[model samples]
Target: MDEKTLTISVEPLEDVKRRMLASLRGAADATARHTFASAELMSRTLTPARWNILEAMTGAGEIGIRELARRLGRDVKAVHTDMAALVTAGLVERTAAGKYLFPYDRVRVHFEFGAPAMAA
Candidate 1:
């Protein structure tokens, strides 16, 4: 629950692709399929750096550009670039308060799988 204090190691690019492929192939059933589909779609829309910004912004709610940079362990200018990219992609928005936030309308990716007997 304490997302701020949580630190996750970035997996290698090969590992990321492998995991994604595995997630795609090993989907348990329909619901799981859809969930993984959403993750994949989201992941594709993100650059590695942009994904970091999303994780940080998602965890912390609204934040300033400086703080986003600090959380990402990058300098201001580098994060400035990431922010611009995310903003352009519509994954994040800069508010009137001069802080960045994920939009209230969260994204959903829909895919139906399997048959009537089970959703998954």
Candidate 2:
């Protein structure tokens, strides 16, 4: 089977807008990307718990919240809360059957910090 990949990135809002415009114009690449306004926001959204959830769900197929919690050895309520945040971030999806899924087989993160401007 072909691999599905998702890219997570910290990008300025303008950059995200440009990419969206490109997509509307059919000029964007096929890879799926989820962009955060800043590294801080990305870190806040993808916490360690959420990251663990993602790791557990990767290629694991649709799973109920209770089963997922059991697999991760976490409380169901806590897992559910993390799952809700992930779903809001578009990193996770809730199926019609009320199961959760991380559709991508792989995840790639891309970001960089530019050097500060030199003072005169």
What TM-score do all the candidates reach, one by one? Answer: 0.49, 0.91
Q: What alpha-carbon RMSD in Å does predicted model 1 have with respect to the real structure?
A: 12.7
Q: What are the lDDT scores of the predictions, listed in order?
A: 0.61, 0.92
- What is the TM-score (0 to 1) of candidate 1? 0.49
Candidate 1 lDDT over 30-105, as tens digits, reads 2211122244554665668876676667545788989878777899998888788777755567889988886332
Which candidate wins on TM-score?
A: 2
lDDT of 1 at 36: 28
Error of 1 at 113 (Å): 13
RMSD of each: 12.7, 1.5
Instruction: Specify the poorest-scoring 10-residue window by lDDT in model 1.
Output: 28-37
Model 2 residue 5 CA deviation (Å) reads 0.2
